[model samples]
Target: MPSLTAVCRVHALLDDSGSVGVTAIDKRPVDGPVEVKRLGVRGDVQASRAHHGGPDKAVYAYADSDAEHFAGILGYEVTPGLFGENLRVDGLDVTGAVIGERWAVGETLVLQVTMPRTPCATFARRLGESGWVKRFQAEGRPGAYLSIVKAGPIRAGDPIEVVSRPAHGVTIGDVFAGLEPEQASKLLASPAPRLSEIVHGLAEKALTRAAVGA
Candidate 1:
C-alpha cells in the first residue's frame, strides 16, 4: 500500500542570500505526529513566499522510489527529507498523479495535488551538486506540491490513500515538462479546484503559443 515512509520538517535555517536570503531547506525526518496547518506543516517556514510557499503549496511530497533513482545517479544515499520533502511516500505514482488529485493521509489530513516543484538556486546549492538545476529539470522527476485541504496531524508510516483523481490526465510530470498544447488545454479546462496559479499560467501560456503558431 502507498504510505508515508518519513514525515519531515524544517531542520535548520541556513543562509542562502543568493535566492531567499535565508533558507529552510534542511528538512529532517521528525518523530511523532506533526501538525499540518492550512498553510503548511507546523514548525516549518518557507524562505521565499514569493516563489515557494502559500495556500497552493502547503506541502511537498516526493516518491521514495524517485529518490532512490536519484541516489543511483548521485552516488550517495538519498535519505528521507534530503530533498526537502515534507512527506516521503513509497509505492505511489507521485509524478504520474494527475493535478487536482486528492490524497487522504493517515486519518484526517487531506491534500490535493496541485503542481510540480521547480528546483531553485538554493536547492542546487543545498545539494552541493554542480549544474544541479539543469540536471534536475532534464531528469524531470520533480515531485508534486499539494494544497492542504484538511489540516491535521501526520506522522511517519502513515497510510496514504489516493482518494480522488481528476480526468484531466495532466500528471505532475506532464506539467513539469514534455507538455503538449492539447494536454495543456485539458489541464486548463479541468473543473477540479485548488489547482495552483503557476500551473494555470503555464497552461495558458502554452495554449496561447500553440494557437498563435497554428
Candidate 2:
C-alpha cells in the first residue's frame, strides 16, 4: 500500500546559504498526527514565502525510492525530512505523478499534484556537495509540489490513494527533465488547472526552441 512514511515540519531555520538570511530546508519528523492547512503542514514554514510557499505549492512530497537512490550517491543516509519535504511517501511514483492528479491522504486531506521542485542553491547548501544543483537536476526525480484541496489532519503511516488524474498524461518527470516538443504540445493543450506559471513557461520554451530549430 502507498503510505505516508513520515510527516515532517520545520522546527528551526538553517543559517543563510548566500543572499537569503535563513533556510527552512532543515525539517524534522513529528511524532503523531498533524494538521494540514491550505497554506501547508502546520508548524512547517518556509524562510521565504515569496519564493517558496504559496497556494499552488502548499505541500511538498518526496518518494522513499528517490531518497534511497540519493543516499547511495551521497554516501549517507537520506532521512525522512532530509529533503525538507512535508510528506515522505512510500510505494509511490511521486516524481512521475501526473499534473492535476488528486490524492486522498488518509481520509480528509485532499491534495493536487502541481509541479516538480526545481533545485536551488539553498538545496545545494543543504547537501553541501559540489555541483549539487546540477547533479540533482540531472537525476530528474525532484519530487512533486502539491496544492491542498481539502484541509485536515494527516499523519505518518496514513494510506495514500490517487483519486484522479488529468487525461493529458504529462507527468512531473517530463516537466522536470524538460519535455520534448510533442510532450510540450500535450502539456500546453491540456486544460488541467494545476500547471503553474513555471510549468507553462517550460512547455512554451520547448515549443519555441523547436520552432526556432525547424
Q: Which candidate achieves the best TM-score against the true structure?
A: 1
Give the worst 10-residue stretch by lDDT in candidate 1: 188-197
Local distance difference test scores for all models: 0.89, 0.90
lDDT of 1 by residue, 42-128 (tens): 998888788877989889999989999999999999998899898999999888998999999999999999999999888899999
- Off by more than 4 A, model 1: none
Clashes of each: 0, 0
Q: List the residue pairs that clash in candidate 2.
A: none
TM-score of each: 0.97, 0.96
Q: Candidate 2: lDDT of 12?
A: 93
- Provide the lDDT at 207 for model 1: 84
lDDT of 2 by residue, 1-214 (tens): 8999999999698897477699999988998889999899998898987779998889899999999999999999999989889999999998879988999999799999989998898998888899999999998889999999999999999999999988889899988888899988988898766478778888899999999999
